[model samples]
Target: MIVCKFGGTSVADAAAISRVVEIITNKQSEQPVVIVSALGGATNLLLDIANKAAGGELLSALQLIEQLRDRHQREAQALLGGSTEAEELSLDISATFDELAHLAEAFRTLGYLTPRSLDAVAAIGELLSSQIVAAAFRHQGHPAVFVDARDVMRTNDFFTKAEPDTDEIRQLAQARLVPLVQQGKIPVMGGFVGATASRVTTTLGRGGSDYSASLIGAAIDATGIEIWTDVDGMLTADPRVIPAAQLIERISFDEAAELAAFGAKVLHPATIAPAVQRGIPVYVYNSRNPGGKGTMIAFDAPRLPVRAIAGKRATTMVKLRSSRMLLAPGFLRRVFEVFETHRTSVDVVTTSEVSVSVTLDDATNLASILQDLAAFGDVSVSPRAGLIAIVGAGISDGSLAIAQAIAALGPIPIHMASLSATGINFTLVIDDDQVIPAMQRLHATFFESAS
Candidate 1:
């Protein structure tokens, strides 16, 4: 069996959904199990509706609901064309909208939106999109079975960012999805949405559909997992930053995970873990250009000096310095405890005997973190920082590769640089404005010159 996951853009509208249908039709021999995200921009619309309603703009929220209802109806009709299944889906879709209206009323009554309530509202898109995708596949004469993901992906009640119970998910997948596949049916599921053990609605965090795919792929012991998105595959650099960035043909699971964690958009950072546990190979492909050669991720891939360069903007850097840390044993823990208390995530770190510097993507808790750290040592905060990462199978251990990177980026001012603990990622913190030019230079040095 193989797991095929299509992203939002792959099922965005009638035309895109049709392309997905064609892809599935051709790949049915693989016993393909399909996973789909919300239609393009559907999740954003749902969240907007919920926020507007809670802010006492029920009228505007309802109006947005109307627009969403119309959009889904149009896409469904264009795909299924007045069939009985289409009619049934229309009712189902309408019922979900009704639930939203009721939820909006509850939000207004409660005067606050809890994480659980927000997840309840956010999950509607995946639910709706999966239903439509299944119906469209069946209309095309394929025996597609739509299974509500909640029934299979049992999770803790963390609500907005629920963690999946893998052991339970494995049991449920074998019992629920295996039977359908054995009976010669295509098992279709929505990604990124699950239910708690108690059956309360919950969501995996944003961009979690890829995580869902990897988990499901591992559970079913699939031979391979395919992530179908808009891009050709993982690229050497962000195309927006380096228009000439070339696609990487294959990557090790560790390298891919490092790139994803740093900022590659092709796959979610969590996507590689479960698949790695099962020794499953994951593939990334373009739904639009299905014939193109895409990237394959596995345990052993050919190592390169530097395979990819990934960067993210809007970062903040924190520096802590004090002589007290010179011979301290638990000083690092004490310093990090402030971040933990505020629930802030530190992205990169570089340290000396008496001073430590860290980069952050979540500045939401910056003020609190700084205030708490002030009690320990002198602290400096720099906003508008950015991170650029060069990923390879042995980037940190490869001194020549690191030398090449520094040589390519010598003109730019780098605030801090650190090699990851596992030695797969070499990250540099710089001014956000230098990201594009730095990426261009690195790509040219590593990829273009090689070509």
Candidate 2:
């Protein structure tokens, strides 16, 4: 059996869902376990409704809720019209939205939204979309069973960014999902939504649908995992930035993971871990053009000096300068504990005898983080920085690739640069506006120049 995950665009509306049916129809012999994200832009809208309600814009939030309701109703009607399935699914969708409305009302009355409450609202998108997709499959004469992901995807109580419990997931999946597949039925579930041990709804953060697919794939010990998105495959650079960016036909798991971590939007950074552990090959394919030669991610891919360039904007660089860091045993540990406490992830780092500089992907708690860091040293913040990473397996073998990447940057001011401990990633901090142009230059130097 293989696990196939369809992204939002793959199941956005009637037409997209029909495309999904065709794709899965061809793969029926694979005993495909289908996972789907919410309809296009559904999750974001759901989040917006929650926030607006919390901010006391109850009327506006209700209007948005009705808009969402009509959209899902239209999808259901278009996909399952003139059948009993249409009525049943419409009621299911209505019930879910009604629950969402009540939650919005509660948030409005309370005048606040907690992470836990936000997750409760966010999970509704997948909850509603998965049901519609499953019903659409059934309407089209497929033996697709709608399985609530929360039933099998056990997670901790971390709320919005909850981590899955792999052992529990494996056990529950075997007991709940394996039997369905064994009975010649396809088990369909929503990605990115899970429940705590006590069954409280929670969500994995944004872009987590990919991570969800990986987790489910590992639990089932499936032969392979396929990620269906709008893109053909992973590219040498973000196509939006470099329109001439070429596809990377194949990438090693290590290289892919590095790229994902360094701001490659193709896959979530955590998406590779489970697949890597189980040695399951993962494929990224464009749902719109399933016949295209998409990228394969596995261990056997050849290592190269530079495989891709990835950049992330809105990075904040934090620098702490202190003489206590000179030969200090636990100074670094103390410094990082502040970030840990604030739950901010440090991306790239460079250190000197008296100073340490690190880039952060999240600055949600920047004020508190700086206050905590005052105990260690002078803390400085550089907001709206950009991070560029050159990822490959061979970069660590020598500095040649690093030298080339730096030279490719021409005169762009680099705030800080660090070679990762793993040696697979060389990252640079620069002005936010320089990310796209810098990525284009580096892509040209490595990928385009030879061609």
lDDT of each: 0.91, 0.92
Tell how far residue 9 is off in model 1, in angstroms.
0.2
lDDT of 1 by residue, 336-442 (tens): 98888887779998899989999998898888898999888899999989999998876765489999999999779999999878788889999999988888888
TM-scores vs. true structure, each candidate: 0.97, 0.98
What is candidate 2's CA lDDT for residue 136?
A: 88
What root-mean-square deviation over C-alphas does model 1 reach? 1.4
Clashing residue pairs in all predictions, respectively, total 0, 0
Where is the poorest 10-residue window by lDDT in model 1?
A: 390-399
Candidate 2 lDDT tens digits, 247-310: 9999999889989988888899999999999999999999999999999999967788898999
Displacement of the residue 390 alpha carbon in candidate 2, Å: 0.5
